[model samples]
Target: MTAIDQSAVETLFTNARTHNVWKDKSVSEQTLRELYHLMHFGPTSMNCQPLRVLFLNSQAAKERLKPALMPGNQEKTMKAPVVAVLGYDTEFHEHLPRMFAHNKDAKSLFEGKTDFINTTAFRNSSIQGGYFILAARSLGLDTGPMSGFNNAAVDEEFFPDGKVKSNFLCSLGYGDHSSLFPRQARFEFDEVCRIL
Candidate 1:
């Protein structure tokens, strides 16, 4: 019978910021695995965990990514220790029997509903991506989530088979505050929310 402390939770939410620059340090593969293990618990629509991630760490892979990025984002992405391609599987509904609870034949729900399936896939994958950022931050790594890359090119380069599509990219590493701009402002809770 103990009251939940709000301040501690708030610190995790508020203190995390999008870091554009990173230190020379590298993030271990074990840490990335731990982050995934923690983030996997976040809920997804129909329990269909459609989010697929490709971690780019080597210089060659990062170089392959440079041409797909916006001019503003290239350097930040290239310098980070790890760059994650957050993507969604186009045929994720095919595995619904295993992913969706109580729905033994869940694939039938999307049999003739391609649009619905795609919408659900993207929606849930985006939620999972948010969870990933929080999980990385909780593990003491900073994140710079950006949508400044060319999706078509990224798809061509990484997911050439076309079964999955890139949603966004996140750079992870020890943050270099030297390049960070001042913290941006946010709307007040009253302005952004409504009490029903």
Candidate 2:
């Protein structure tokens, strides 16, 4: 396959920045749905596709999420147009029969294996979270993904049934670029990768 245009690459990665401040614009529910539709195609092991999302967009919803957020994250989350609580389904394997249809025994690989289930759930959900960010950027939205929060508190508040577990929180909106810090540095390919 041919490479995507450089501008698309810039939108998804090079020019994208983690935004903490937001402009006074709202993210429509339709946009959120579109974003998920775009991101959900990212591949996962056994096609487990475990990521689940809860978006806080109202004052009451933000207030309910407040106590679970870290002090440093509370203001940004409340002010952002949308705060996405990204999580994973504990029973994600139950869907393997349909999602991993090529392999009828896919669910059996995870069933009754507590440690394996948790690891797969977290790992695949994290992979999907990366897709979520890129999809948002491609749609001209800004993202601020942060992990400074109480996992148990979030799970209790939003996933009381214990069927899902929170992984991270990401704020989505039109970013306030005036307040952005300078872009940070990264290591060269050789510094972090190896050819086998």
Candidate with maximal lDDT:
2
Clashes of each: 0, 0
lDDT to native, each model: 0.90, 0.94
TM-score of each model, in listed order: 0.94, 0.98
**Model 1 ranges off by over 4 Å:** 1-11
lDDT score at residue 46, model 1, on the 0-100 scale: 82
User: Candidate 1 — what's its lDDT?
Assistant: 0.90
lDDT at position 38, candidate 2: 96
Tens-place lDDT digits, model 1, residues 1-196:
7863776465358666789888999999999999999999999878889999999989899999999999988987999999999999989988888778588778888877879988988999999999999899888899999999999999999999998999999999999877788888889999889999
Which stretches of candidate 2 lie above 4 Å from their native place?
none
